[model samples]
Target chain A: MLDFSILINNLDTYLEGFKNTVLASIIALIGSFIIGVIVAVMRIAPIKPLNWIGSAYVEFIRNIPLLIIAFFFYIGLPSIGVTLSGFVAGTIALAIYTASFIAEAIRAGIQAVPKGQMEAARSSGLTYLQAMRIIILPQAIKIVIPPIGNQFINLVKNSAILGMIAGLDLMYFGDLVSSHTFVTFPVYIFVAMFYLVLTIPLSLGVGYLEKRLARSH
Target chain B: MFKSKTSKIAGVLLLSASMLLSACGKGDKETSGTAAKNALEQIKSKDKIVIGVKYDTRLFGLKNPSTGDVEGFDIDISKELAKDLLGDAKKVEFKEVTSKTRIPMLNNGDIDAIVATMTISEERKKEVDFSDVYFDAGQSLLVKKGSAIKGLEDLKKGTKVLAVKGSTSAINIRQKAPDTTVLEFENYTEAFTALKAGQGDALTTDDSILYGMADQDSNYELVGGTFTDEPYGIAVKKGNKELVDAINSALKKMKENGKYDEIHKKWIKSH
Candidate 1:
């Protein structure tokens, strides 16, 4: 029989890989969100050095392929005494690569909030920090939601790169299964379906959050 | 700096977040029950063996789409080992691994042995033990038909030679041709594809792989004399003397019985 019992028999391995893939995405998403916020603020800062740092970060990371960045963490870091496994390298690269886009989205979002709102907050005896915390960020986040959602989707797909360094993500296990079974099409289709299984609910959740936030507004 | 306080808050948040996010998602093996222990005893006691082989390599270890079996010389070797150990070759489990994986999988106890086209080198010997060289492979270059690169001798600075990640071929290229900049892919197919894409001057790997690539695409031809002596060996964990001894004995038995030659001919002739 040409049926694929190999994939069925290898469910545990595939599931283990799925766990890693989701773990990497979760880490990358949180990492990029925090990084984007900081960079967005720095990019819009009046200080020259901070602005330069922000610009340099965006340009330097955006220019490099995510896999090269992954290699930097996985292989290059070891020379300087910092060693990371493939999964860590993949996640870190995912975080750093996605951060550039996230920061752009966030900066635009922050700027989109009416300048009058910040001015009003300042006139009311609030410090700059107080105004941003109390009035600016909440509104900026609303404008930033859609673009950030796209980056989230991208991060999930990019998580597949972990297969290169054997990060044991879903794609890595899928490769293992497909290579063994020789049912490349069905095995990969299964992997795609699994990815859909993860992303569909995530997209729905993002949509619901957007709707709820709009209703509150 | 009208919003100095705001900037400070942002800076702190960004730094903390980068640090915090970087902290999650780094680990080694997360093995559960049915996990591997002391490498030597694990295989002999388990009643069967799991040998890791390559999936993407052609002739030597390819997934035959029609048969649904990982066909090639390496698969035959793995099955022979199973027969030697457990009395039935079909009882052994096959785990598909790439060059990047075969080692970690071995170290983590995910596999009992690795019989892929793994070359024995001093650096790798530090990590695992190798059986006697089963196949004597010489380095060769695969190039598009009538391409300028004649052989390894013609390789120059910035001459991208495609190789798989974690392969000694990359290091070998560096050592043999010091000035060449090597472009590594994840596996054999990508290296060959990159070669076709003109990403490199030549694809340098074992002649077997280069020949397989050539067979797939007539535009590409295998060039270059064998420069480095890459002897393929079955890898077992270092200090797993028992498994090593068992594997070596099995090889010896198969070779003496002429079964090794028969199996080798079975898989390699088509390449």
Candidate 2:
């Protein structure tokens, strides 16, 4: 059995870390999904400028490491007169970085859907937006959910970067507690379990949705 | 009947979860020395004083990697104070704190007092009370021991100074060398590492912390005298006169009885 007396003794501090991690992940998850969806759509848009803009965003963010993206947002943006809290910076950077991947996944899914779907919707008098919203998107969403879920799990793990800026997230707490307690292994194992507590369910939920979406398909 | 039982179970689970959440935060803040003493009384009236400390700082404090026990100068001071306050020095709890969150942790009643080589500054005084300067330190630069950089004045134009964000050193560097770029890192070790890795020409922080790094690596040394005074002090919550008085009295006694000097020599001078 794992010796957890130290963990039990310091459970309160770890819980604070857990709260910070969960909150940061949730915020990043929502923000990234929104950004991913928007950019994914733009990447396939008809207009030349819009397509280039989206392509640039996706490529630029996708190439950089998440930490660099975070620092860029945390430090770089401040130079241009925008300031953000560590949480916001971390969450936004996590979202934007992961969004590139999410956008790629979603774009792949949309492309996998037949051009016939868009064509059929257009022939039936639906606008491009309407076709994307009602017809093409539903199938694309189902196809992209699992990969997007993977990106989300990564996002949750990546939330730790916020601590570099003192975001007070779970990873920050972990770093703080472990450095203080000098028990990095057990502290991390506890944090890993906490992450599993959030992500395991997500994985299961994704698996379930993947199956159900397959069935409906 | 099933619904009632289910609801009862849910209620109990909720209570337990909340208990775990509050358990970590349940300790009361001691502003005046009395609250700290009362709280100490509440716990040590049962037996144990949990003192939050820093484990990253060398000479001042550090966690021994092998034993997983934090030990250093500040730790020794707290231990001695515990002996005076609780009648048994061993009945103490240690928590780690960083510069940014140390004050918040103290304010939130997480630890009784912070003995983390905290610098006494005017801005910090608004939130917490300080015992007299227990450790004399100031903002200074640490570089590779053989480096030619003598002091802040000697740095070439466009020199980079590594410092942690929100640190007084960062503000100090900007003031002293407005044209230089200051690369802010998260903590002491990173800044030091950055200096070693050639990310920056010099690392700036309290000399005590720099000494900690120096103790670990001979290649690096404090390059200049403290450019700004950064007197270290023991911190307690603002308005906690009881705990404050007990700590200050204990500190005064520690200094008078030569326990302070003995501790100083043992952790600092002996090294």
Candidate 3:
């Protein structure tokens, strides 16, 4: 039979792991949002070089596996005299990987906004930057809220990859505990529950926001 | 509308609760059957022995990437056992096993015996029976050649030690150096690679495995003689006294004939 006592006995270890997972997710979330906005702007920019750079970054990152990216930061970087703690390296990889998807989502959102909005603002003497800032981005963000929410949820789940690099995330500690105790099935059940604790609320919040946004529209 | 939303939440909660209940209900059922005849008698009739050994861990049982042949001290011992039993060393089959898979594979009869570099512990003895200790190993540390970290004592707050997940070394290091951060990789190779990449100050595992790493890379050296005594034993299914006795005698004969020394010298001494 599955024993809940192992979980109760080592509740502190699981909580510590959960804390790391949450921390990594929050940092990646904020960092990816900033990077995503910039890349989205660059993709929509009038300049040819900016658009190419933005497109290249999104395509290149989105194509590679998250594990490879995490390895590159965790293993590859140290060879070049750049050393980062596992937590830092994992956060950077997660943020960079998630940013690519966020950029694509925001780009789609930007395109969904009617072209007339941009033209109307430009005709009123707003600079291209001002027109994008004041007229286009706010509406584009609203259109992207659902997808952005989806990405955030994915980011939380994907953070499990950090466990591979010994980033001390929930999955890492779960593996350690399961192997030590040899209660593989229950340890994972507990891990899944911890992940659900983070994800279910985020999902519900997203649904609430989506409903509110839909009603306002 | 709010009532509908509340019902939806309740539905999800109910569904998850049922799933959890079902999972808990499906308790592990012990497989029972008529006591099979001794394993030695079965092996002789079948004309072969299936042994599970690690395909990683350099000196212990790593597979050569080029030839696909597993070569290590553990491999040699399994072959010796096969020769002693079946009159031919080649009458043995080697299956790859990791630390995590070894016990389940043995319990389920996926493999007849496990000759992997498995450490015998009191807790594990409940699940499986072990032959007399074939090799003595101990938990030790591997550090870069020029590292200032000398041993486990040097591991303090801010010191990062790399080890493989699910390994006793990982657990031992955590208890030994509670303040020191331990980062576990999936295997010794990965942990050693991390050490080379400057991810950790030292890598902790069995000295036998560490010797293998040091053999492969001149830049690393084994530091701090073994801290924990880790005896390697060949494990068979629990309560298999006949098989255990046969293995113990085979091991004794090998030692008496000086074959054990030769194999140990060939692998362990050279490194």
Tens digit of per-residue lDDT, candidate 2, span B1-271: 9999999999999999999877644443233444435554654575666778877788877888899999888998999888998888897899888776687787776677889877787867877888778888788888887787899886667776777755667667778878766666566765665565555678888888888888888888888688888888888867766677788888899999999999888877833
| Candidate 1 lDDT tens digits, B48-126 | 7888998888777888778889977888888998899788898788888988788888887678789899988887788
Best by TM-score: 3
TM-score of chain B of 2: 0.85
What is the iRMSD in Å for candidate 1? 10.8
**What would the DockQ be for model 3?**
0.60
lDDT value, candidate 3, whole model: 0.90
Query: lDDT tens digits, residues B1-271, model 3?
Result: 9999999999999999999887655522212221456666777877899999988888779999999999999999999999998999999999988877888888876678999888998878888999999999999999988888988889999998998877788889989999998888877667877899899999998999999989989999998898999999999998888889999999999999999999999899964
Model 2 in CAPRI terms: which quality?
incorrect
Q: In candidate 3 chain B, what residue range of length 10 has the lowest lDDT sum?
A: B26-35
The TM-score between candidate 2 and the true structure equals 0.58
List ranges where model 1 is wrong by over 4 Å: A1-217, B1-41
Better of 1 and 3 by TM-score: 3
Which of 2 and 3 is the better model by DockQ? 3
Listed per prediction, chain B TM-scores read 0.82, 0.85, 0.85
Candidate 3 structure quality by residue, lDDT tens digits, A20-116: 9999999999999999989988999999999999999999999999999999998899899898877889999999999999999999999998999
Models ranked on TM-score: 3, 2, 1
Going through the candidates in order, their DockQ values are 0.04, 0.07, 0.60
